[model samples]
Target: MAYDLEEQEKLEALKAWWERYGTLATAVVVVVALAVAGWSGWRAYQGYRANQAMGYFEALEDAARGVNGPGGADAATRIKAASDTLRSEYAGTAYASRGVLVAAQALEEKKDYAGAQRELEWLVARKDQSTLQPVARLRLAGLLLDQKQYDQALAQLNNPPAAFAALFADRRGDILAAQGKRDDARAAWQSALAAMPANAALKQIIQLKLDALSGA
Candidate 1:
């Protein structure tokens, strides 16, 4: 009887514990299940989006290639449509950024500087697009320079990424030269030449600029 009483008391304690905590335990299980389902759904949606964005990108490329062709206007329209889709529906993807670059190049090649500048500025404003920011910065600076917006161009070229250091220096030199800051231009050119790969064709071009400044 004593042994039976001990077992009964243990069973009662377990029952009380379950009565107090069963509802909370079930709620935790439900929450975990929903979280897992949500994660899976999110992943699937992202994959679908990436695939759709790629399709738009491919179309953009073909259209971009034709933007300088005989039917340039028609091609430009197609590129605009595809790029618009990427920008609006798939803005978070690499394809979206690449599409913007392609569209900008096409617009610039047609001498549409305002349109190109707008596209490049759009790319630059996307803080999430770290991979494409430097490219957009360089292109935007070039556009500004062509427009004689010297101050704006110089500001964009400031503290360029390491990969673009030489090109940035070269652009700065151009801007400084245009402003008639010969000494500063020469310094910038020298910096560009120093940063350039040895025996690169661009180095020769930079050297000529430096030589010109020497005579000035």
Candidate 2:
């Protein structure tokens, strides 16, 4: 009789403890399960987005290369359409920037300077978190320079990243030289030469420019 009574008391205590903590324990389990499911769903969605972006990018490449036909007006139209889609829908993806750059190059090759400028300007305007921003700006500046839009080109070359400092200076020299600012051009080229790596192939070219400037 004593052992039976003691076992009953222990059982009652266990029941009381569970009644107090069971709800909290269940809630924790539910929260953990939801978090895991949410994470998995997010990963799947990202993969889907990436795949879609890749498809659009491939189409843009094909159009740019004239893979579908002789690559005339039809190809240009296709390239524009595909690039527009990528920029509008997948601007967050690396492929979007790449598509825009490719489209710009193709348009420039076709002597569609206005179209190329528009595409490059769009990319530069976004100022998104893309590493390609620098490239876009540089290309835009080059296009402006070719058009003899000196002030606009200089504006785009301002405050370039350190990695591109030498290139920017070199281009600036070209612009200044075109404007007949000989001393300024020489200084800019000297800066470019100083920033270049010792074994850089461009170093020799930059040195030649400097020497030519001195002779002039």
**Residue range 50-130, candidate 2, lDDT tens digits:** 999999899988888873356578888888898889889998988889998999998888778898998899888877745
Provide the lDDT at 100 for model 1: 94
Candidate 2: where are CA atoms >4 Å away?
1-14, 67-69
Task: Tell me model 2's lDDT, rounded to 2 decimals.
Answer: 0.88
Candidate 2: the clashing residue pairs are none
For model 1, where is the 10-residue window of minimal lDDT? 1-10
- Using TM-score, give the best candidate's number: 2
- Candidate lDDT (C-alpha), each: 0.90, 0.88
Off by over 4 Å in 1: 1-13, 194-204
Q: Report how far residue 132 has shifted in candidate 1, in Å.
A: 1.2
Best by lDDT: 1
The alpha-carbon deviation from the true structure for residue 110 of candidate 1, after best TM-score superposition, in angstroms, is 2.0
Clashes of each: 0, 0
TM-scores for all candidates: the values are 0.84, 0.89
Give the alpha carbon lDDT tens digit for every residue of 56-170 in model 1. Answer: 9999899889888998998888888898889888998999999999999998897778878888988998988888988999889888999999999999898888988999999
Provide the clash count, candidate 1: 0
